[model samples]
Target: MIRGIRGATTVTNNDAAEIVNATEELLWEMIRANDVKASDVVSVLISVTDDLTAAFPAQALRRIEGWTYVPVMCMREIPVPGSLPRCIRVMMTAETPKAQEEVVHIYLRNAVQLRPDLSLTRKSEL
Candidate 1:
């Protein structure tokens, strides 16, 4: 079986270090929540808001131990008026035994507002 795990997070600014740090954090959380192993991952597609240009979020995935062979790609999210800014979104497809409903989607930081229903944290807490 195969499933897709969605995750998104935001960085406070456009700093390269901040983007890398935030992306890595989000990836780790998603992995932990779903118990996903790098070996099982098929590919990861990442999109970032136009506002974030300091770095490629894929850098974080490349840094993960044992993830060297995983395919990853990054691109800009479609810019819509009043849409969230400085956000990084990821769709990770992997071979897993879990059902679609069993996969946990993660939304963190300011990006939580993008999908309040899937977010574990309340808006007030962000």
Candidate 2:
């Protein structure tokens, strides 16, 4: 079955390094939380708030040892007033045996507000 795992995180600055680091952090957390292997990932779709034009969030995947083969795309999110800035979000599709209810979605930093119900606590065990 194909399952979707959603995650989001915020960068403190618009700098490329900050964006890449924050995106890497979010992706690792999601991978750990979902117990997903790179081989299981079908594709990853990433989006960033309009304010974050310094870097492509998908670029962070290069640092993930085995994720080189995973297909990824990045886009600019619609600029909504009052929406959080410097937010990087991802929707990952993967082939998994786990049911939808068992899938874990993650949100960190200011991005937690984007999906409160799916947000994992900082101390939550994966």
| Best-performing candidate as measured by lDDT | 1
Model 1, C-alpha of 36: deviation from truth (Å): 0.6
- lDDT tens digits, residues 50-74, model 1? 9999999999998899999999999
- Which segments of model 2 are wrong by more than 4 Å? 120-126
What C-alpha lDDT values do all the predictions have? Answer: 0.91, 0.88
Candidate 1 — worst ten consecutive residues by lDDT sum? 117-126
What value does the lDDT take at residue 46 in candidate 1?
96
Residues 40-116, candidate 2: write the lDDT tens digits: 99999999998888888888998999999999999998898988888999999988888998888888898888877
Model 1: colliding residue pairs: none
Candidate topping TM-score: 1
Clashes of 2: 0
